[model samples]
Target: MSVPILKQGEILIASIQSALSDRELVELRDELADRVGRLRSRGVVIDVTALDVLDSFATRTIRGIAYTAKLRGAKTVVVGIQPEVAFAMVQLGLSLDGIATALDLEEGMLLLQRWPK
Candidate 1:
């Protein structure tokens, strides 16, 4: 997996590419956590449009990613969940409660733009 960061002022969109598998998710959790730690946080948008699935491990990783980003002083928003991936993620019993989610990148960017730096 690859995490490509796109910066626009106080916004940082981390576009994740490739499948988010169990082992890969672990690596991402650590790597993304470190990346978040190093950033002068603003807001984070995880663009998972390129990913094909969202299993339990992947869901956990995302939650980890969000928490880690928050620790770095950034609000994390997950975006671009495909229909199938959404269904899978929901089936994993992951709650969106306090977490933010967007159907597409455009909406994600808009929301991220509104977040406080």
Candidate 2:
């Protein structure tokens, strides 16, 4: 299923409520990038709290989204990465690198707000 993306003020929040295949993940990346520009958003928050598994492809796609948003003059925060998922990502050598992340959606929003305009 397609992820639900919501707009709150100048921020775009995409919350993943279920598991998604690689295609869906890629689609999300593309759609978020498009919305960032079209909406002239100042930040993008992707909530993956419901996802229990995060493979390399998913990690890469999320990082790509962050980069794309940055290029569009908007910051991106990936929140809700469970401890198990983070451990698995580390075991697989997957990393978010330059992307900012938080424990949950609320913190993610705060992080975005603190970002320099």
Candidate 3:
């Protein structure tokens, strides 16, 4: 599976770096909705540590992603933003304002698992 999903007890772990077309992302979101069905409680901790830069399109995709995750009864926590990139995003005003971010993956997952209901 190009988008490999990991099972960790009740949580689903995914490290996403897919450079998909907008249409493809929409399709992926639909598939993700199906995958997350029937879960009592769940969350996603996305490690975007490898992506050096984020443009408008990517940022929009992430926003849509958070929305999709919410629809599937899950929350999304993003981690691993390089300082330089953060600066760039800040200058571009692309900082993920409402989305959660963390210093590292460990902290991000902790925050996601402990998210308020």
Candidate 4:
């Protein structure tokens, strides 16, 4: 299934509600980039609260999406990461190097709101 991308003010929120295959993840990345450009979004928030597992490919795809959005002049914040997923990502050395993160969607929105345009 395609992930739902919602627009709130100048921010685009993508809530990942299921496990995505590599192909789906790639599609999401492209869709997000296109939307960011077309909508002239100031920020993007990717919510992964429903996901229980995150593989290396998924992690990298998210990072790629963040970078791509940044190139299009939008900041990206990843929120709602489960503890297990966080541990696994760190264990795998798949650090979200340059990406910003928040504890929840509310904080994520706040972060984007305060982010420099």
TM-score of each: 0.82, 0.97, 0.78, 0.96
Lowest lDDT block of 10, candidate 1: 32-41
Q: What is the C-alpha RMSD of each candidate to the true structure, in Å?
A: 2.1, 0.9, 2.5, 0.9
Q: What is the lDDT of residue 51 in candidate 4?
A: 90
Clashing pairs in 1: none
Off by over 4 Å in 3: 17-28, 38-41
Distance from true position, residue 100, model 4, in Å?
A: 0.2
Instruction: Give the clashing residue pairs of candidate 2, or none.
Output: none
Candidate 3 lDDT score relative to the true structure: 0.69
Q: Which segments of model 2 are wrong by more than 4 Å?
A: none
Give the residue spans of candidate 1 off by over 4 A. Answer: none
User: What is the C-alpha lDDT profile of model 2 across 30-90, one tens digit per residue?
Assistant: 9999999999999999999999999988998999999999999899999999999999999
Return the top candidate by TM-score.
2
lDDT of each: 0.76, 0.94, 0.69, 0.93
Of 1 and 3, which scores higher on TM-score?
1
